[model samples]
Target chain A: MPGPGEFELIREYFTSRFQTGSRSGTADNGVELGIGDDCALLLPPAGKRLATSVDTLVADVHFPAGGDPYRIASRALRVNLSDLAAMNAEPLWFTLALTLPHSDPAWLEPFARGLAETAHEFGITLVGGDTTKGPLSITIQVTGACARPLRRDGASAGDIIYVSNQLGAAAAALPVVLGEVTVSPRQQQQAETAYYAPEPQFAVARAVEGYASAALDISDGLLADLGHICDASQLGAELNLDQLPVAVLAHSLQADAAVETALTGGDDYQLCFTVPARHRDAVQALQLPITPIGHLSEEPGIRCQWHGKPWQPRGTGYQHF
Target chain B: MPGPGEFELIREYFTSRFQTGSRSGTADNGVELGIGDDCALLLPPAGKRLATSVDTLVADVHFPAGGDPYRIASRALRVNLSDLAAMNAEPLWFTLALTLPHSDPAWLEPFARGLAETAHEFGITLVGGDTTKGPLSITIQVTGACARPLRRDGASAGDIIYVSNQLGAAAAALPVVLGEVTVSPRQQQQAETAYYAPEPQFAVARAVEGYASAALDISDGLLADLGHICDASQLGAELNLDQLPVAVLAHSLQADAAVETALTGGDDYQLCFTVPARHRDAVQALQLPITPIGHLSEEPGIRCQWHGKPWQPRGTGYQHF
Candidate 1:
């Protein structure tokens, strides 16, 4: 008998039947050549700079092994799409390099399904990639187009900082996944949904396009990620403790614990961005769920304030070492 | 104390010191934004389709775990560069999604050195990607430019099939690497060199440009790779068994073993391209060790012949199960 081959596996699980995003809407059929070739060809929209990024997810490191393969697949694709969102780029296409120990259709069917669903939802077309024999790992590369690319170093000292949504739900879900804590089924489902299918803030990114100066998706907790923006923009941030959008499920923890999680909870795929003081009223008038959590300043390091007084902190969540 | 953190590690080892492949030479400075950004930006040359390919290399699957980190890094970058060569595209920039058990400078310095060396040699710049904790694997995504991109589906009946160099040296080197065989010091070095670093046929690809109808680099063995071309082009191939360019190390094996190894052995990293009858003279005139081992035909599958007698093959090559 023939080997359980690469092409056969791709054809069985990763082809047109598994296509997620609808190509008819906004995506131009930019795929000149796709799978079954030496390399895939893509036509970048005329006169637009191409924005490309890559992210890899490994079992037991990024997620628990033996977890829901469908959700795992979705997290991998969406996080990379989050990078496209961070750049304020219109989503174009993606390629996935998947390495697995075995070609079990049981795992692949739902995995491919989730991948397709996320792709279609994000309007991302699958271009090409390679699958090979190895430990369970996925590396997703996404490319998009942008004219006025928002960068992380463009924030001025007087800019106001904002985050798109509430924080810490995914980080709060980890204890439930590890069975260290119990939650009501509804809360568990909510946390798991946040953990598995991260909203990449693509719509929020578009809404803030020219108005936002420096931006990044909050992946490494609010503190560490804002520290990143501070490092890039050569400025610091001052956060008002009372203004943070704390998630409902995290509120179940001790008061201090809940506030800590909200402040430093990683895996919140919300946009953290800055707008100059001159544009504050204009940005606030947009009337989106944009929260004014902090302000960029000429200070040297993060200064957290509680009830208008200096508040000391412990650690930011999920520092990848 | 701070964690042996991701951003710190990147700043210490993977910064400008690791920039390889001079943009001043043949490589145009296509990088509009690079390593520090959310997504690196590139201005693709006008009227050119962007050719993108991704390849992942895993330790103990693609290479031994404890081998030299530098050589392993070089191999990972080069094999992906081979894909760009196959498509006959000019190198632009690449993003690397690298996973590691931990960040150790001893391993990373040499690894970054090797990565930079190969990047400079290929004239490709490092763009944006993520580093996370996981089993060690490297996924490289390369994008290049080509006006008339070479593909596998354009071969015609009566087209001549050519390969860039001798085959099976890397596959032949496997046993030596695994301690299954012994050879002279010189022979061991020769085999190891081929195994650790397979040369991509970039110059040969340039020579055959606009003349070759369909092209691919032989990562899988000659028979298997040619079969891929035939499958894509909806044609068959007739190869002269005696005409196979078996490398000296592989040639040293027994008659049947040598033939089987030459036919089925993989990791050759040689170019297999098809040229129309009309452009045969133009292609051959370039004269860079061009070898006519076969011809595309109207049949449906690959047919190997020796001295006008049909040869029954053992198997095509390594099939990734």
Candidate 2:
């Protein structure tokens, strides 16, 4: 009920504290106007195209209610950055629209700190935003620049698919976070870290720009996300079950549970993409940490090959209905 | 519970429905890409600058909790558009971030229709956005273009002040909206119309460009908004209270209440600006419906005169604290 008002909150937590994330160190690095103006002014430089994405995280829906404020703030910003990363766009500027039930200083201080830290780390400037009184929610609109952004419909049949990092660690953390399971201190720490701060694959853009034909970050899980590419590209996929790069935490679980989680559970925030077979040598030579887990097929839907026998998984993936 | 999933929701409400707001009859006038894939792509034309602003309107805070979704959605987009008007930027495109308690079909159908109608009327496109499950709130981020945007810091001493339209109609409607008072049917309709759909003075940009020195739209009442300009420009204002333009509905009230509402109530959405004396003829020659309400001074705060006698208004303006 008691807290700083809107103007004071922005002054203390956002405006005076905005850090420029441009590497050029120039005052007018494309942001001719910011923060205090009626509208921020920007230019997309010459010859390059601009790509923009908007995402929202609601309390107790996308994240746990009353979770660590710092983790919540960091996760919100990082997930949007992951979207830009998937499109092979360089981070430029982002605007945050935050709704809060009240202006509690204790909650806002750490949230502001986390937001600043994450924005700086990702090299994205806080250009402008809105803070209003309401139930807690964070909505971010990000803008970036790139020549030819990766698209979902660019994949071709016979293209090899790749997945960044391992899957199921964040999913493994969910039960522990919801207090439905118990685990060792180390396991708990690992799962929590993976869940709270899934890294945006920033380097993948440069590594796969000219090589990967199609790409996107896995948010709703591998099966569902790949289904998106199949739907858009009008191509099917064949995944090798044994070849999946399972995270260490998932590997510790029962084999079936690990496999199921790896296939269906959400929140991985890793890139799942397809590259032409002809570019295999060039892609592998880039030496990035990615694994070939599957291949696009001329068939009309996803088909799994487990232990060299055709099989279907128990569920497709997480669905936000 | 029983509603469209995230993907279907987007397909129904956004992706399949984007249309051009461009007068050029070309699909790619300003939007390089829209409402598909991970992000929307946009570009500023040759020799133009981009302007952007984000605003949020919350249920119960900005409007009634169970208010008509059509009106609510319309008001939210219009208010943000007004900010672009103040900056003298042409309407381009906008992204919406909506949080809802659930996927209520009855609510969404009307909301989406209202959104599309208002967007078409304003000549803007729906680029991209996020829809999440949570408390009801609407956040809109608008990006536009202009050669040179008007700013709050450009007002000089001896500049004549102007208010785009009559004030206090929205304020007079508040008591009726809150059910604190009753008014004649005609008066209720007029006041409510003003409160819900306060027109953004879009003509001010072309009318005052190169003539007016400083500008901003009145959202937080006249005195408080004028204070903002003074604070930014390091100048003061002399307001002639008797000369203030009063809306018909406000004039229908008791004289004191009418003047009080006109002077102090918020939600006018009209442009308040300062024009140098030398350019006054050029500005008036534009033949816009604007009133000369005051003059700028070297002093540091606002001073008011009523019928040639010094007087004080009751309050500064609305504050969301």
DockQ of each: 0.75, 0.73
- Which tens-of-lDDT digit does each residue in B129-185 have in candidate 1? 778888888888888887767788888999999988888788888887666789888
* TM-scores, one per candidate: 0.95, 0.94
Worst 10 residues of 1 chain B by lDDT: B19-28
> What lDDT is reached at residue B320 by model 2?
68
Chain A TM-score across all models, in listed order: 0.93, 0.94
Off by over 4 Å in 1: A1-3, A18-27, A253-256, B1-3, B19-28, B253-256
Off by over 4 Å in 2: A19-28, A178-182, A253-256, B19-26, B178-182, B253-255
True contacts kept of 2: 0.77
Candidate with top DockQ is 1
Q: In candidate 2, residue B209 scores what lDDT?
A: 81
Instruction: Give all candidates' CA lDDT scores.
Output: 0.83, 0.83
